[model samples]
Target: MDPSTLLITFLFFLAALLYASVGHGGASAYLAVMALLGVTPAEMRPTALILNILVAGVGTFKYIRAGRFSWSVFWPFALTSVPMAYLGGRIHLPVRYFELLLGVALLFAALRLLIKPGGEREGLHPFALGWALGIGAVLGFVSGLIGIGGGIFLSPILIFLGWAETRQVSGIAAAFIVVNSASGLFGLLQSHPPLPAAIPFWMVAVLAGGWIGAELGSRYLTAPWIRRALGVVLVVAALRVLVV
Candidate 1:
């Protein structure tokens, strides 16, 4: 393979490793990389969603198997999110608008990574189902619109509200990413655009990285430094998108 393709493959693996460790699907990071590579917005969205599915799928299985997941914490949000994500995927934006919005999204993800929140509170707060549903709907729509799985936003919300523990948040976020990404991809497929030919190689790289990261995360691995490093990369990519 060419050097550029090899570099992209390696970056994809690294993104998956860091994100899956935190129960994310790495869609934002993938988008940032593509943005740096000068990929069109139309290609970026579906490609990111496809990668999100593979990586987050691994995280979901690992976190659930490790008993970090809570059904009560997961289902209410997912119920509203699925349909909203599908709806959002069906609506296409102008290329300029999409790039602008995606740049903002990359910045947000970078911010989330840089500002590491404290661990779960001693006493978990009771979740408000109504609030969760509303937030989920909004996030889901944004996910489909921006090609993210929404875990980047959801994790912090849960932490700020003290609704779930850190591990629980990770597990729930992973599962949430999976469903939303899958729903978004399904919606995108209706337009019948061909995916990038290199998707299979990217998928294998992400899966390998995702598995190792999930294994470490589910057991006992804290990666604040890794997150911060990735955050810096996202900031650069976001700047690239906004400037060019």
Candidate 2:
């Protein structure tokens, strides 16, 4: 492989490690980096989504084994998201529009982190199901369009709604990402044009980096810090997408 390809792969793996360490799937960073490297948006989205599935799945399993999984809090959102994700995958939007929207969403998410109100709750609220489903569907659709795993939005919503603590939220977000990415990939498969082959070296690098990072994140990192860091990264990524 060429030096440029090698460099890109290395950057990708590094980004994966950073994101996984924070309990993110790294789609926003991946998209920004790919854009900088001149990858076509068409290819970048699906590729990032595939990577998200791999990383998030590993993290989700870790969270689950640690007894942090919350099915009741997760299922309603997942139910709404799966179909929307498929729909988003089937439709192709203008690249500039998609990027702009993603940028705006990230910015909003960043602002949310900055101004997050304090909250504490014992369990899921009965009325939050509708909100969860609606937000999940919107996030899922965007995830499919952008090839993310939807955890970026999911985690924030959980925090805002007081459904779970930060660590538990991370685990739930990982599981949610895995499920939505699987559904989105299934949808993408039905497209007229199929996805490109997984670059074996890149895949291996991402998987290795993600596993190591996620393990450390689950064991050592605090949820609030993870969320804050993820928000900051998203903001930077959004700016890169919009301006560069």
**lDDT, candidates in the order shown:** 0.81, 0.76
What tens digits encode model 2's per-residue C-alpha lDDT throughout 1-244? 7775677788878877777766677777777777787677667767777888888887888777776678888898899998998888777777677778767877897888766666445255444777888988998897776677888777766766778777777788888888888888777767644343445676787888788878877887766677777678668767966886
Question: Candidate 1, residues 1-244: lDDT per residue as tens digits?
Answer: 6677688889999989888888888887788787777667668889899999999999999999999888998898899999999988887875566667767977887787678586436226788999999999998998787678988778767766878777777888999999999998889889986677687898899999999988877888644543564466557556755765
Measured with C-alpha atoms, the lDDT of residue 142 in candidate 1 is 81
The model with the greatest TM-score is 2
Q: Which candidate should be chosen as best, given lDDT against the real structure?
A: 1
TM-score of each: 0.86, 0.88
Model 2 stretches with alpha carbons more than 4 Å out: 114-127, 192-198
Query: Which portions of model 1 show Cα errors greater than 4 Å?
Result: 95-123, 222-244
